[model samples]
Target chain A: MNAVFQVNNLNKSFGGLTVANGISLSMEQGDRVALIGPNGAGKTTFINLVTGHMPPDSGSVALRGADITRLGPTARVRKGLVRSFQVTRLFSDMTPAEHVALAVLQRTGRSGRVFGNFGAMPDVMAEVSEGLKALGIDHIANHKVSEIAYGQQRLLEIALALALKPNVLLLDEPAAGVPQSDTSRIEEALAGLPDDLAVLMIDHDMDLVFRFARRVVVLAAGTIIFDGTPQDVAKDARVREAYLGNYANARSSV
Target chain B: MAIQRAIAAEGKVDAGPNWLLRDLMGLAAVLAVAGIGYLLFPNNLALLTRITAIALLVLSLDLVTGYCGIATLGHAALFGSGAYAAGIAAVHFDITDPFAMAAVGAVGGAAAGLLAGAIMLRGRGLAQLVLSIAIVYLFHETANKASNWTGGSDGLAGISPDPVFGIFGFDLWGRTAYVFGIAILAVVFVLLRLLVRSPFGMLCRGIREDPVRVSAMGASVNGTLLRMYAISGAVAGLGGALNAISTQVVGLDSLSFTTSAEALVMLVVGGTGSLFGALVGTLTFMWFEDFVSAINPFHWLTIIGALLIAVVLFAPNGLYGTATQLLHRVWNKR
Candidate 1:
């Protein structure tokens, strides 16, 4: 499998506490990888470093074999490496349609045009509606984002990332604040992504992780403990001791 | 590459609907008011013309502060710079053609905008606001110190503009000047209307909503804002040049702190983001001031202060913004 995205020996720290300690990973096109770790394991930091939200202390991130380590977040997004937030970051006053439409406009490179009503652009509108429909929130397209339920907001978060048409998509946490009943909708929407798109999801819910991820990577104390098939990750002695055992109990209660 | 190609191809298509129609209605309202003023108070045309120029200043302020969410109290620097540039061109360079003077004003204002934007955009919120105010003071002092060029604190004098298109002389009754000011205001209003409704305008709105999200969307938020600032400067400059031409004098009051504060007040009173609000706010404020001062010059400011307080309490969105919202609500219900 050709690695569409590669992270090599990334290191980052805040004060004396190391958040990412020489982490290295790669994802092939069409790969579905779940990164699971205990709290403060630096999962979000690692994602931030890769997506250009923060500069890694040492390491390189490459997309399609081109080095993107020094690029800013927006430049990286334009290179087709996109990320959704841990907590949904959205324009509170805008509608889902407007949010997706803006993304579509950015994708099409028409965001800088000083003339033309964006809502009237048929191609952009088509892509925006399609993105909303993909996330099962087309019915609420015209409703203001702040007026929507938290679950719908979370789904809209994914919808935003999808509209960017990223070659490598990083989801910080797709189901963090979503209700239990709405998890299925997120899962279903995630399930519908195209086969060739690479995705890396950082999630704490092991049941969802094990369900969605074909391969699971376990992180503990800012280091990778295991990387293998989901079943092997579930059974790994070190992973069980470091993280998964506690998750197993939490999953049963939930 | 594909994105670049799409932008190259699709960038020039007509932005849906007639955004100009909205601006046209606004211009029509201004012209109608001007016409009524001509009939009812023929002697007060000069005051009405001055209001037109100040309305342009307020409109320009709305672009940066209202639409782009740049907190500023230094916009007077741009206006004053424009006025001085036009006055200097007329007196020293003998380029008295009104259009030429306005162009000179636009260039001067754009330069000031570039300088101010470079310095002010480095910070956000209070830092930005304070820096903007400082820049205005710096420009004001610079103009004051250059006694020979700017006529110092005595104000620039000995300037006269050639007949607009070499025909319409700026008459004492201000018939020509009044029409000229309205004409410039109308053209600028139309252009700004198109600008604010366009895709670029949408990007600015997004930046105002959340700059981080806009940046994450692969946009250069600061760069876009800088461009908006320059455009806004040109508009304000045009207003200042119109003032210089009509009055044939440039004053230190143009660069004073009060001008900046008053322009901002007019913008907030009109509402921030909407162009029509800018016009409505300027006209209402100036006319109300004129009427009140005539009635009780000593206590006119108190009345003005009370009116501003009432606006804040009752029309939280400013008069025009609240009106637009109400109209939209009614239209949606129907």
Candidate 2:
């Protein structure tokens, strides 16, 4: 069976610094993987390379057995390879409803309609409501994104990614910058993601990572140092030296 | 649910049943204002007609710059192309019909837009601005060098448009021209109102704020922006044809750098995104210019400069945008 997402020897570099060095990874359907690394360990770079935001110097990224390395970011998204940014990238003046509505329209190929308003389309609105409600942000859907809290903004990002009905989701630090008090809300949203959808989340929070990931992949110096069950991830010697270090000991004890 | 209720309550949404009433009211408001202008400036109809044409140019600029965030200073390329196409059609091809000339102008403008959009959309921000400036110069030089068709720097002349539906003739008093210009403006204004409120408009708005995010949502940012540019070109072209038909002359000044810069200024002063703001800005700026220049021709430019500075400083969102914000606040307080 073809893996839902496969990356083969992905290589990228900026001048002398290599961001992705021969990174080979694959995920099966329903995989819930957490990608954790140090600040400069190229986690975000890997996501960028796979999602087609940045071109790979040498490698191939495939989804459902179809190679998509040459495709642009927009085309990759249309093929159901969607991602969320670490920093919440949203339309500030637009409402959450507008964002989700646009996503739904784009997904269904109706965003180019120059004559009709999305508000009048009952089917579109129904899906928008459902998506917002699923993220527990339906009540504030009508409010402008600028007026919403940062935590809610993060949730909106996830909501946007999910609206595409992606087969493989790459979430770049979904809970970053969100308050500790609001972290649970994000975790809840993460937990409630569709069961059969493959999710690859990059996060720094060990607790969230350990709780959410079925398998954890650790990267250090643009190379995958560990790829195993969360339990074994903390015990891996290379992972301890490169990333986990003292935290791995503490995490294993807990 | 509350979402449905909110959608319904939101005035900008739901372009279906309510749009007829809204559009009719908008049309009525525009005609009423035109009627007042006609009553007040019966003798200055030519000036009013010119304002109407420039207003259309500013409106088209708003679509790309204001809505899509594609900063351009070569919009006059599209406008001038329309004027030249209309003039050439009438003078050379014997297409004397005003409507047919407008159609030719629209096609001309759209072609310019496609060419300009392809080049401009390649680079963003300062690069995009520079490319637009370059394009306008190229177009200007091309127009100048093609003397036979464009009449060189002497300007394209001998453009005579047929009467509207074989009834109202293009007269010396500029009466028919002014009335025709207002009628066109009203119709275009109404259609644009619908265009900006549609899903496509929302997509452009999304692209304006965060194009990267829009792309992640599976939209081709350049493609969407290019399409908008073409539409903008068409509107500007229509205005150009109107000018050609009204004045029976097409000049090199229509394609000049100053025309593009002035259109940008008018759009900014009126406010960028709002169609109403475009009209308001054009009317306010042109009327103030005419009113002041007529009094003191030499110092008029300085006064206009001061007014622009004041508007940018106090009303950073442009006159219409700032006024609406204040009105909203006041209404909320009430």
How many backbone clashes does every candidate have? 1, 0
Summarize candidate 1's per-residue lDDT along A1-254 as a digit string, tens digits: 77999999999988999989889999999999999888777887888888788899898999999999999988999999988888888988777777887888888888778877765677877776678777888777777788899999999988888888899988888998898988999889788887999999999888889888988888887899999998788678998787666677669989
Candidate 2 per-residue lDDT, tens place, A1-254, comes to: 56999999999999999999999999988899999887688987898899887999998999999999999999999999999998999999888888898999999999998887778789888888899999999888778899999999999999999999999999988999999999999999999999879999999899999999999998988999888999998788888787555467558989
* CAPRI quality band, candidate 2: medium
RMSD (Å) per prediction: 4.4, 3.0
- Per-prediction share of native contacts kept: 0.62, 0.77
- Model 2 Cα displacement at B10 (Å)? 6.4
Candidate 1: segments with Cα more than 4 A from true spot: A244-254, B1-15, B18-21, B328-334
Worst 10-residue lDDT window for candidate 1 chain A reads A241-250
True contacts kept of 1: 0.62
Candidate number with greatest DockQ: 2
Q: Which whole-number lDDT from 0 to 100 does residue B246 have in model 2?
A: 90
